[model samples]
Target: MKKIYFFLTLVFTGIQVQAQKDFQGMAVYESKTQAPKFEGMRANRDITPEMQKNMEERMKQMLEKTFILNFDKSSSIYKEEEKLDAPGQQGGMRIMMNSFMGGGGTFYKDVKAKTYTVDKEFMGKEFLVVDSLPKLNWKLEQETKQIGGYTCYKATAVKEASKTDFRNLRPKNNDDKKPEDKKEDPKKTSGETKTNFQDNFELPKEIVITAWYSPEIPINQGPENYWGLPGLILEVNDGRTTILCSKIVLNAKDKATIKAPTKGKVISQKDYDETVIKKMEEFREMNRGRDGGPVMIRR
Candidate 1:
């Protein structure tokens, strides 16, 4: 009985020690100085009905835009975490997304975020929490560098073009041109027609996201919209560079329990992508008939 009790005590002690070594420090992504360019995406259509519904319902829910992530770095398993929110425009509509990675590989959640404004001391700014999927398979690249006294690697990834079945954007009588069809379609006689709008951009193209992971941290996590690295990503860049862990304080005096937040609708990343496309198409079709905007239109 004495020997058995000693073994059980030793096992419990080992578990406690392992639990203490997970991810515990805050990984900071500081935005470096870059010249701002005034490029705009002109969309003739407005927000879709579905998107409008979501905006109306959940726009007021507070989100954590910028956060200080805390975790336990003692063990391979990360069971808890916390996100500390700051005050700013991009800070309020922020969300905590959870993804799982292991021998089974990484799986992401399909989450939708509404556009919102969080008042800041400087000025009122806007940010968007778009619903998207993990279309790219992320892996470590050969180029490596040291960050926060730990070795990190760069990874390249991309999201492929997805085809969606949405509300019909094509004209109803596209295939049929009989005499009866012509008579039935009065709008055809009027010159108003649905025009095919082409949005030209490359798809399934490579998107470069430079991430520096530290083996010292030992937890697979990152910032903004990325993860799946072997260690905590200290820095990540995709043209617009987001450098994380520019400053890290190890063995700080605070105990931050990092746990995934439970909120927002969780769906497969693919489903979320499809929903976004469907909404976009619906919005475009609804606006196609407008002339010089709705306010100016007589009818």
Candidate 2:
């Protein structure tokens, strides 16, 4: 009897090891952002009822989005699912509006290497941004909850807001001329020269991020750049944005393709940010005297 029991124990251990080794799967997440209220316009009596309704609808469309994470033990690929335009919104106006409100690109993370890569498109040009993974000082708590049928533990961290988070306000410019060349142009005036509005516009310095992770999955991955946890993150709330996992497939028979995106100009994250800020300044310069255009004011 003892010998039989020992043999059975060994067999069960082997099975458990195999199960842990084959823990590759995919997770689907739905994210929602709280719509901003144009309080200034409302207080000044500049917002009409029809304009308010349109703003609400547009904000809803921009804030609600879906993403998929295809991950294994040490690496993952997170990308936004492509969404079709609304019916009857195939006109040039729709395209122009969408150009201002863009989504993030494919993000790849390698936990072992401590690196991340993002494929982003600004204006019409593509760029591949490579950078180190964000080092979040997460405070793991004893608090727990259930998400998507998995028991999750709570963790919180504080991080600086990323530049990509403000993509809507920083629309890209397609001009090929350099900044110095643009200044020397005879048609350009001092009043129309580029101004760094971002300097005056203060974004939140630190965002409080909350995440719920499931140890059952045993993978250090999550939607977007949130990672470095002992388990799979099932839900994340970063004040303005919330990402919740709707479904998780473990050891799926049909494995997902987890590959890095390879299309765009290769650049570091710092360089890309500088390029974007400069372009946004140029865009402001180009539209300095424009009247009747959309005005975006953040309070």
Best by lDDT: 2
Candidate 2 residue lDDT tens string, 83-199? 787775444444333334334678999998999988887777888989999889999999998997899999999887665455223222326558775545343354332323432
Stretches of candidate 2 exceeding 4 Å from the true structure: 1-21, 39-48, 90-102, 167-201, 293-299
Best by TM-score, which number?
2
Q: Using Cα atoms with residue i matched to residue i, what is each candidate's TM-score against the true structure?
A: 0.46, 0.75
Per residue, candidate 1 scores C-alpha lDDT tens digits across 23-119 of 2565544543221221111223665666644543332232112234444442111121244543432432432111100001111222222111111
RMSD of each: 13.4, 8.5
In candidate 1, stretches whose alpha carbon ends up further than 4 angstroms from where it belongs are: 1-23, 31-67, 73-142, 148-151, 157-206, 239-243, 289-299
lDDT: worst 10-residue window of model 1: 97-106
Superposition TM-score, candidate 2 onto the true structure: 0.75
Candidate 2, position 23, lDDT: 64
Sliding window of 10 residues with minimal summed lDDT for model 2: 191-200
